[model samples]
Target: MSNKRRRSIFEIFEEYFENLEKWTERFREALIEKPSWDHRACTMEPLSNIMVTPTEVIVTSDLPYAEENTIHVKPVSEDTIEILAKMKRKIRLDDFGITHYKGGFQTLRCQIRIPVSVDIDKMEVRFKRGIFEIRLPRKQERDI
Candidate 1:
């Protein structure tokens, strides 16, 4: 009898997963590596950081050239929030001495999801020295 091996179903699945892994890597590099600024929207995504504490969740963004009076924070949901602020002046690549890109941004904007429960109604905001900070009081837990 001639010896021949038939591929099992597990072998087929392994090949499929390998291809999926490669595709995911390509997708991450193509999308995640893009610039933060959106030229068409006239907006720049400011650098931000989030911290969760026992009593509050603190979110901050670096908003250089931003007009404090124009800053607006909107809570889209219990866990999601959006920040938008107008810049005091349009910022262009030329300001940084970059000649290849041609565009200017007039707004600072971003959306983020909070990882913990927070009381948005009592949230406090502050802007100083080009830093925007928001303090949301964490929801109090009750005994059932």
Candidate 2:
């Protein structure tokens, strides 16, 4: 008797969408359905883009289509400040669409450790152009 092998269904269909671009889209959608924690940022890094200068440190974040009063900032320690934001989810179909109530809560909380202690008394925070900037003064240095 002669030996014979049969190909599985997948082997036949593999040639149908042989292009890399066509297959890549399906692969990407499959990955999004089950998102992983790696999609999130590190805990220590600021929630958004930030810049620290010699005189002050600036932190910026953008939350468009968000109410002004939904943001909260708290000082956890002498050198750390935590920011928490709650944004309203939007619905394109209706004002109270089904999608709006589903996963309507969005939270971003991160503690920023300043290189120098911020003087809460003189601290300044500004929210403009969907950017939140916190200006903290540099600590005074004492000579030896």
Best by lDDT: 1
Compute the lDDT for candidate 2: 0.59
Angstrom error of the Cα, residue 114, model 2: value is: 1.4
Candidate 1 lDDT: 0.92
Which stretches of candidate 1 lie above 4 Å from their native place?
Answer: 1-31
**What lDDT score goes with residue 142 in model 2?**
75
Pairs that clash in candidate 2:
none
The residue-by-residue lDDT of candidate 1 on 99-134, one tens digit each, is: 898889999998889998888989999998899999
Cα lDDT tens digits, model 2, 5-85, are 777889757766576667788888877444211213311122466677877777666655445687777789877777766
Residue 85 alpha-carbon offset, candidate 1, angstroms:
1.0
